[model samples]
Target: MSRIGYARVSTIDQDLETQIVKLKAEGCDIIRSEKVSGASRDGRAELATIIDFLRPGDELVVTRLDRLGRDTRDVLNLIYECEQKAAFVTVLDPHVSTRGEMGHIVLTVLGMVAQMERRFIKERQREGIEQAKRQGVYLGGKARLDHQKVKDMHEGGAGASEIARAVGCSRMQIYRILQSNR
Candidate 1:
């Protein structure tokens, strides 16, 4: 049976080293990692690959249950998929495994807790943003493209495609900026 490992981080800035190290130490034969949100399985290509490549006797390992996913439904669905493949999932931190009957019950409870914690985090973030707005200190997210530059380029007879390339933005963004100006 092969022991496979999976690691994930929500942001590009976050480190996956700790999880990787732990998984390696746990005797994982192969490891796959990605820098992406665990809130949903949408963009997690590495995780999708691991799931697709799982074999009957393979064991998927993660540092924590939340590392697999923050959504209870998503986590449960992943576990079900693993079960369908006749594979096992092991969470190192809480030391839970799908190799036993009790593990399923405990994992379900932990998954619910993780989802609840994510909701709490988002609620606190919304409250903080609201407070900041009330204090007139919230400037909102930073713009990825310079609107002024885009406007200037368009006004200077630059085509949407040319302006997009020059401004380091998508053609759709250039169109939006031009449309907003009109």
Candidate 2:
């Protein structure tokens, strides 16, 4: 089977040397690299191109699983696509290479860990928001227009369209806030 490497960076200023060194050390035949954010949908051109070029029995290698995607879902999807194409994914860091039965076990365990981390983060955020609300502090964003002033204006016969224009927001926003405070 032929082995290939893919490397990526979020921006042009970021270094690709470390990833390249690792891929080269792993004996990659050809390294496909790019500078793009993992969060960006259009940022993974080099990766997509490399996947398209792979044939059956080809191995796709990356420095780490996180380098392959911004989140667990995207990472697993990419891995699944590789498997569907009869290719393999080998992650250099953490030493997980999913090309065989044993590797599948590792992948499953890692996926569970990733999912748990996501859930923990979400729970923590929920707790933080609840705590902030209990403190009676601003738990959310500040109003674009002052609530009291808006109420007074509306009560003073200011048209909804006029308030919206003065506040630099849509008429729906003014009406919604007014309804809420009432």
What is the C-alpha local distance difference test score of candidate 1? Answer: 0.92
In model 1, the runs with Cα more than 4 Å from the true position are 142-182
What tens-digit string does per-residue lDDT give for candidate 2 at 1-182? 77899998776558999999999999999999987766534647789888788889899998876577656667777888888889999988788887678987786667656566667877998898888899987459654478787888999999999998886665767989899997
For residues 52-152, what per-residue lDDT tens digits would candidate 1 score against the true structure? 99999899999999999999999999999999999999999899999999999999999999999999999999999999999999999877678988999
Question: What TM-score do all the candidates reach, one by one?
Answer: 0.80, 0.59
lDDT of 2: 0.80
Which structure among the candidates has the greatest TM-score?
A: 1
Name the weakest run of 10 consecutive residues (lDDT summed) in model 2.
35-44
Q: What CA root-mean-square deviation does each model show from the true structure?
A: 4.8, 10.9
Give the lDDT of residue 88 in candidate 2.
94
Misplaced by over 4 Å in model 2 are 108-182
Supply every candidate's count of residue pairs whose N, Cα or C atoms clash at under 3 angstroms: 0, 0
